[model samples]
Target: MKKTSDLEEQLKEITQQRNLLLKALDVLEEGIHVVDSSGRTIIYTKGCEKIEQSKSDYILGKHISEAYELDDETSVQLRVLKSGIAVKNHHTSYITSQGKRADIITNTYPIFENGKIIAAVSVNRDITKLGELTEKIIELQKNLYSGEQKRRKHANGTIFEFDDIIGESDSIKQTIKIAKKFARSLSPVIIQGETGTGKELFAQSIHNYSSRANGPFVAVNCAAIPESLLEGILFGTSKGAFTGAEDKSGLFEEATEGTLFLDEINSMSMLLQTKMLRVLQNKTVRRVGGNKEIPVNPRIISATNVDPMESIAKNQLRNDLYYRLAVATLVIPPLRNRLDDIPILARYFIEKNSKIMGKNIKYISDEVFEIFNKYNWPGNVRELEHVIEHAINMADSTDTKLSVQHLPPHLREKFTHKHHFYKDYKVNNLQQTLLDIEKDIITQELINNDYNITKTAKSLGISRQHLQYRLKKLNIKKQK
Candidate 1:
């Protein structure tokens, strides 16, 4: 009798705790759904009811397939239950029995009991309204981008040509040579490089050089838009598809007979990448919420700020999509790797910004060149341009050249700490001269070997360890 009473007490406590947790979940803005192993809906919170436009009583105790318009393969909850895996930030859309559409990003997890999968839980966040808003914003941006074409004095939407790519490095020249070859064939091209390495510049150049140069050149940055809306934006949306969807043409259609440049393709969701691959393969695109397959003949050019193989290894990029898009690959070397171009680029930026700022900045000082050679340009040419623009902005009326004092404070401080006080040059200091010579020799060797430390060390007849130590002591770093 005593044991029975204790058992009853424990049951009561567990039920109470479960009720409390359910109540807490109900108060959240995101919907909470729980299902048994058999796919029956065991628990549905108030948030779930609100988002789905259905009452919890109607869903609870019903199999998920009957409760909602989802099957075993389509249902994330069921998928998690079967695989005992978590599906995180996965976007899906379905219609409620109430005739309302719910677009949501779901994070579904398998619930384990005693090390066995017993149930599944899902947290769904409504992105329907956000998707609508993004659509409106995208429409506005499309108009804005279209209007800029006239201002740029270019047909379609391209402003830069091959000549605009201001780099003399062999790597850049070779990349351009390959891009020009790709432009002749109407096949897809993939440009891979670090951020700010002008991957888009190469993409635009390829488009301008292609036969489709006369047609529209549509460009989209995959990372800029939400994954939920990106599909509708890339593929057209049909009117009556959602609450406020309209009959709109997607970028693929917009760039028909031209080029579609997908920047940061690695940022696209795998599901979207699959859709893109299908469209590329078929040369046709279907509108979201529509059943029509629109034929598109746009030359595809995709750019990624990540290595294709690395992104594929990490599962950030779809392997099939990478292979499909990389028919022609162009790799633009980072600014640090092409150190020889720095002087020419600096001079170009100086002249350009000097004209804009109404200054006569004629030269970059020798000391400034030395500092440039030492610093790793992580942000690449864009960073160099911005640095030059900033120096030009800060230049005095009497100054004829950009000097150490005129450099951005961060660069100025780094140079001062690493090298010497340019304000007080010590020409007779033999130790300082020797240090300068050693630093110059190392810098030259690094450049000669394409910044390969091992090769540089071997050429200098020093151990790799010794070279690394010397590099660290000298505060020399490769671009990240």
Candidate 2:
């Protein structure tokens, strides 16, 4: 009798402990509630006031269904409490004060007493904003295969294959062949290029071609994230690793058995660079404040607009890390070096963005070609995309032709240069130097005239015969 009495006392103490824990949980800033035996929400925490976007005094005694409505699928979670079972991370929708709906994920567990459920405890997390931000990833993916189109990616979206690579140039084709071969190996690869040269596209294409195509293609912008938060974000933290932290997975870990593309990697701090180097060497990562080492087999791909060597010289990136990264590097040529591809790339972007922006774009005019040919595209592919998109918008919506006159003022500057007169005509020491000067002058004249010889000569304040003589003598081919 005495032992059984002592045992009952111990049970009472345990019950008290549970009650105290429940009270502590209710006081948390996170949304938490308790449904007691009578199906009354007996414990209403002010934590939920913010998530429901409601005032603290308004929610205390409301029914579970009365306080929040559910979408079609998550409404079934109500049965879990009724059946005395536990459910977690069940995604549901909530009607906010503005009468707009948002997504909230909940974790619910039934509290048992003497082998019977006495109550249900729930924690709700709002994730609607996060869900929308997640769609930007699809935007990045679409940017890869889209050429000039603006669209977001979805699960059902078509992934890029080798055929999606649009270039007949030998260098581009050879680069693709090497990329495809390396993609099959699933090793770390670095793509080096100037800004807007399609580094992410190549990364995505390589991922799609790899064995890990079915897994997530996680891309993180090292430059975009702040250094303070970057470390925690790259290597996730344990629950309450610091104040207000829930369990979060870092990009490298989240991309387990997949590919993790760290863009503008030179932006990572020196401290984080050391941590990253270890992960690269060990194929493992330790969470912040976590002692356990996790083996990650994700393929690594990094890209940068700035030259990696230059970055290393500035101490932005470690020289040792640079050597590890450049085992197989691919350098993308600027658009000026690949002028033959300009028309093809331009028309592709015009047609695609036109369809998306609902503008009618039919053809590129000879004037547009002259504009394309004369100017060096310093902004590369991305600049071309935006310029064409702007042209589509500025032209008559029904008009299908794009000409030089339609281009913006800034774009016109590329083809414009002030003729510098040498006071002495004998400045050239070599025939090549004179030829070069005359070639530049003739080219400028052609651009000023829209490549029309009569108009060009008139612009140069000279006769067409004189312009033709100089162009021929200098062996300068006038743009057609």
Candidate 3:
């Protein structure tokens, strides 16, 4: 009786442990699939069901290749079972029994008992979303390159030039001067500026100003692309590089004899930075999973929204790559720093947008300009242009001026709340201050009314004769 009772207890403990292990496997995010020596599925996890869009009951006890609609030669689990070796980090794609395509990065290990391979256990991570996104990017890249090549035969790829830049500020002028000089050289140039400060504008201008102006100008934003695919995009890819990789020319090869603008270069990974540095130094590129070296001579122009030195300190950017790319550097001053240019930029945008929107906006009001000057433009020139565009949209077709009421709601609310009644009032002797304030009010009213004395007097609640007398006393000149 005692021996029988001990045997029952051992059986119960084994059952509990087996159940716990099964629970743990089902809860994992990655699919755990186990197959026997004969390639029959023994264990199929819930994760597998979710990823493959099939039920475990339908897969378990069936042949691994048949369940996943894969062949013995292509199946990682079957390959591991046949070779008795572990395949680590293999990128593969297969169609499920349900006929849905699945992309996975898998690690298949041979399970052994008594030194003989008895089964294979594979851990799989679904990368279908990432794979689809990569495919979309590749398609877009193909379209872009083909379009650019076609356009190159007709005209240059760049649309902007130094003359297109609308800034009279000393800071911008100085930056542009240095950039024009950099354009004459074949040395790599680095542009540093805050976000929305038109780093790409300067890059394109430099490219158009250079000897390579007639060649293809390719621009890619490093920060906008996925790190996993960036290397393949920049260095090209080989036919067998990954599951679906093909023999494709990268940005460097496409930009050969032209200029390749890498915007936000600091966003690139350190590993990619090292590889890029090697390519830059050698003036050639080796495709991913390819052994052949292709020579490229594109004028490399890299930009960073952040300070490269700070990026280096944080280990986000490689110091060596920075030095190589920054042979000639141009720093664009932010909009806040170039406040003197606001009036001109605002006017320029207003005129440009007016023609586009078919509105007759002739000027921005004094109050609107005051708000613009006081509010720091964090998005720099882009934000200013957008603000002007938004204002024009709000203005009536007959409206000759954009006013505070026409400003974007958020900007209007922000600066309007901070505006004090006395903020613009010059404090001095009571009589002089009052006289000055009155003169300013009458002058603004006259301008707002198109210098019509009758409308100004009616708007100010004064007689026309008294308004005329005040205008003369203040020596205010009205244009005919």
Candidate 4:
């Protein structure tokens, strides 16, 4: 009786341990299945039922080939059972016995007893959502590329007109007059100016006012494109020219019967400049891999931030190309030279931004204007506009005007430093001291008035010619 009781106790303990192991397997998130050496299912978890969309009873005790309808090559467990080798992270798509499809990444390993294969166990994770996500990403990429291609195709469209340009200074007015005259002519035009001086604004205005207004207006930044690709971009390429090359129209062809505005023309490579000169002379283009010449009639309007003559001297721009592009030339004066226009431009920007930002700003404080007058605007009109926008955003909601407190931190610090420098200065030489003070005053007034030479001279109680002489004597080159 004692021996039988001991045997019964041992059997009960084994059953309890087996149940505990099975319970642990059932709690796993990944589907776990075990197959005997014959490839028949010996264990199946609830996770397997969820993954395969079938009950455990339908899988347990059934052959893997019968339960999952998998062949030797497709069934990971069967393959592991036959080879006694583990299949790590094998991916496959399968349909369950109940006709449910799933994409899964599975790991199947062979169980060993005394160095012989006893069974195979598999852990599976469904990756259907991951596959769907990959397809969505590919679709988004195609759409993005398509949109960019469309933008390039319609690149000739003008984004601004003559009325869009702001400023009433004589220098600006004269530039506009010249640009208007150039607009009526088909001769290629070259616009030269410093950075941030609204060169593109003038180019766009000229295009919009010209007879080509009805046609496309394509603009290209020569410096922005890689030298290796600029040639093909400007003249296009033919299919079979190289790997993945496609037959496409270049900017010149796209802007046919319209205007082709080449910005930063000085930055173009010499080889590209040679090709451009040829195109200008012949009024035709040949694709990169094509020998057939295609007639192109785009009115070229080129611009450079630096002096074209200087560019020619430095060999950065081809002399022949310069002469061709400079049939008419317009030089845009910099903001420091046009200080008298600052208030006008500032007020315009304030009102514009007020409407855009939904603010009730009605005025700009004199303190703000004082700071504006003292600061040298190296970035020109664009910088001024941005400053005003930033101030508006920083202004108090209840305040009806922008003040110095709302100015950029850099500008405030600069003003403070300059004030201290002037306040602590000790006059050692009377003439030199007076001259320094005069220069400082003139510079401030010039900035305050938006660099309008006429207004600045008048404000300083001197003639415009006198102001020009002082500017030269002071070694102050006009901003540009």
Candidate 5:
């Protein structure tokens, strides 16, 4: 009788332990399910009920196949039971008996009893929401970067406006006045300027000042894209047109009721020019492989570094296209032509760069301005901005003023050889002429060798120490 009572007590403890483990499994976020070797479900937690959208009462004692309507090949638990091998992070999609769809990632492991398959356990994670979120993120990225070769040239954003254009010169003012006037008109405007003369800046300013300011401002560089893809880029492609091609909107369609700025328009192919002329004439565009004509009403703003007339003469730009695009032409003068604005531009850039670089640059030396005015800036305003940024970075932390010492080695060399000797010679007597000439030659050699003391000395057929002495005597500081 005592043995029977002890056995009953032991069985009660085992059942309580099993119930505690089942309760623990039920609290987990991941679905926990166990099936016997015969494929009958032995355990089904509340998490499984939530994941499958079914009650445990229906699945706990039934065959997994009958309850979930899944086969041995589809059910991860049954696969593990049959194979005696664990399956880790297997993805599956299924429709539940209640008609609810679910995407799940599951891990299934077989239970071993003395090397014999007894049961299988599956841990399921419902990732339907995560999958939906991932899909949404991918779609947003596609919308931002979708095009042939993933070209984002016509991405919808503007970085500059009329107020951002920094120039007080009369020529720049006149250009701005014409650009403002062109903004009010829907006619296509052509901007001609040297590279880096802020052609795109004017395009953005016009877009911001126009009636289409609320819409997207798309910009594309004709020279940046391949010639073969220009047509499809300007006019969209339809599905079934080619392998891997989908129904895609071109820049013209994408910029509907907005502004489309085509930069370096002179680089467009002749065939594209003819197509563009037709679109400008009819204000309609047909896709590359489709016959349907789409009426696009976007404001056109084209820019070129080359002269439009010269481009036409060289067969680079179509005469008819030029005439249509140049209805309100705005020519931006180069930086050298507007020397009067250099001081203001320099001060503005200094302040701007100071804030960006966390510096306290208060002044630019007169010598620096003299060199800036003398150098012919082939790269224009953009080059000037870069030069200022370079100077700010080269300036000493303790120095509040930008000086010739902070200038780039090339500019410093040019300035030292060109102006410093002549100015000093004129002020001093004729006795210093020979010394000044020698100093100029030594300085030029030092610069040519990138301020290498040994190389400059060797090129001058002197010792490194002697060159150092000459540099100090000439009051020229070698950058450390």
Candidate 6:
């Protein structure tokens, strides 16, 4: 019994020393975790806190059966726990906060000490910078491997130089010149215009022109994606925030060191407007379930169709956020206002689509110009393009001579068709012009009616003698 007791004491001492070494190693080693079979977390380190964005004290002494989630419902812990195996080296993504975003490299291991499962340890390494470096290498390789057949987009997704754009209009030329200058600066710019006015085009021009054009040019349509999805798309979430998280890289993250073009920013819900305001303010963002703040360095270029001030008054936007975004505002002239450029823009599209559709056609009639200049276009350039395309498809001749008949009915009715003169003549200035031109018309009508005063009065919607006297003052003869 005495010998047995001595052996037991010696074994206890060895176990104590080993455990001491382990605790010390846990402190010294960079990444650490303590997870149990339930896929619930038991404890994590300061390094793990830096990685997983979780503090040990906050999660201590609880039933660590729930696995960490990337979105809402998806869980790494649940998967690891149920399978009774370790999940190793899975990649996860981040929401771009400031320029300093991060990606997580994850490894999950089943915990065992003396032949029994106790906990799991997960190690995560941030790969934000690695991603950027890889992109650089890819770009370099492309430049090297295909030196003969060179085709590349500028960081802002545009080709450099006047030769890049195929328009000769003074407006487009001037706009491009100004845009190249705008790209050099880092300040926020507001692209204001009607929908389909090429606000995106200008935004891309500015981005490609800027010094930071080497970065990503991520275009996000605020109106296209719903608010719920946008939060995760913008800020990003961990392995599990709510569920089913495969880990996503938000647009903000994708645009690191580049420009983020928020198209139709006016359509963003007011709640997201407030959240966006916070991003602009801090230049750092916390993921949906993450505790650590990540930095981001991308430029923000926001576009809106509505007047910024009007949007604020309507309570659809936060005034503070508008001010930040509108630090530099560029109002893209509407297609109607820039009517001088329509011919060039039209030919460009026609040439492009014609090449694609295997059609060789050219020319626009002067009457087509008359219709174009006269029509009050509600849909702007996009509408015009559609109209031209329709006209082209319907044309019997190879030449692109679009006439009044070729115009869509809604557009054609406002001009000089005989059936529409009366209703089409409704205008204030023309009303005054008609008053002067009417007496001669009145006498002509009266003569046609054989000067029957009652019939003339009835037709003119006035007394017969009143019409005759007016004809005399204007010297419109009472024809025999």
In order, the Cα lDDT scores of the candidates are: 0.84, 0.73, 0.85, 0.81, 0.81, 0.66
Model 6 misplacement above 4 A: 1-174, 397-400, 419-480
**Most accurate candidate by lDDT:** 3
RMSD of 1: 11.7
Candidate 6 positional error at 174, Å = 4.3
- Model 1 has a clash total of 0
- Indicate the TM-score of model 6: 0.56
Best of the candidates, TM-score: 3
In candidate 2, what residue range of length 10 has the lowest lDDT sum?
148-157
* lDDT by residue (tens digit), candidate 1, 1-480: 999999999999999999999999999999999999899988899988889889988888999889767777767788899899899977777777577889888899998989999999999999888877776776554455444454774766667899998878898788788889988999888998998999878888888888888998888888978987789889988875643457999999999999898999999988899999999999989998799989998998899988899999999999989999998888889998889899989999998889889998998877688889998999999999999999989877766877765789899777655334223446798888777778777875664344667767987899999999999988787643
**Model 4 vs. true fold: TM:** 0.56
Better of 5 and 6 by TM-score: 5
Off by over 4 Å in 3: 1-43, 55-58, 61-100, 105-125, 134-156, 355-358, 396-398, 422-480
TM-score of each: 0.65, 0.58, 0.75, 0.56, 0.58, 0.56
lDDT of 4 by residue, 304-395 (tens): 99988899999998998899999999999998888878999999999989988988888886757777877788888989999999988986
Rank the models by lDDT, top first. Answer: 3, 1, 5, 4, 2, 6
lDDT of 6 at 403: 47
Q: What alpha-carbon RMSD in Å does predicted model 6 have with respect to the real structure? A: 18.7
Q: What is the C-alpha RMSD of each candidate to the true structure, in Å?
A: 11.7, 15.1, 6.6, 17.1, 16.8, 18.7
Q: After superposition, how far is residue 259 of candidate 2 from its true place, in Å?
A: 0.5
Local accuracy of candidate 3 as per-residue lDDT tens digits, 1-480:
999999999999999998899899999999999999999999889989889999988998999766765667768788888899899877767778898888788899998999999999999999889878776865564345454445643255666789888888899899899999999999999999998899877988898898999988888888767776678889999886654567999999999999999988999989889999999999999999899999999999999988899999999999999999999888999998899999999889988899889999998878788889888888999999999999899877778988776788888678654223333665768898888877777766675555667767987899999988998898899755
Position 480, candidate 2: lDDT: 60
What is the model-wide C-alpha lDDT for candidate 1? 0.84
| Candidate 4 ranges with C-alpha deviation above 4 Å | 1-156, 418-480
Q: Write the per-residue lDDT of candidate 5 for residues 317-340, one digit (tens) a residue.
A: 989889989889999999999988
Any runs in candidate 5 off by more than 4 Å, and if so which? 1-156, 418-480
Q: Order of candidates by TM-score, top first?
A: 3, 1, 5, 2, 4, 6
User: Which prediction has more favorable lDDT, 1 or 5?
Assistant: 1
Report the Cα lDDT for residue 349, model 5.
Answer: 92
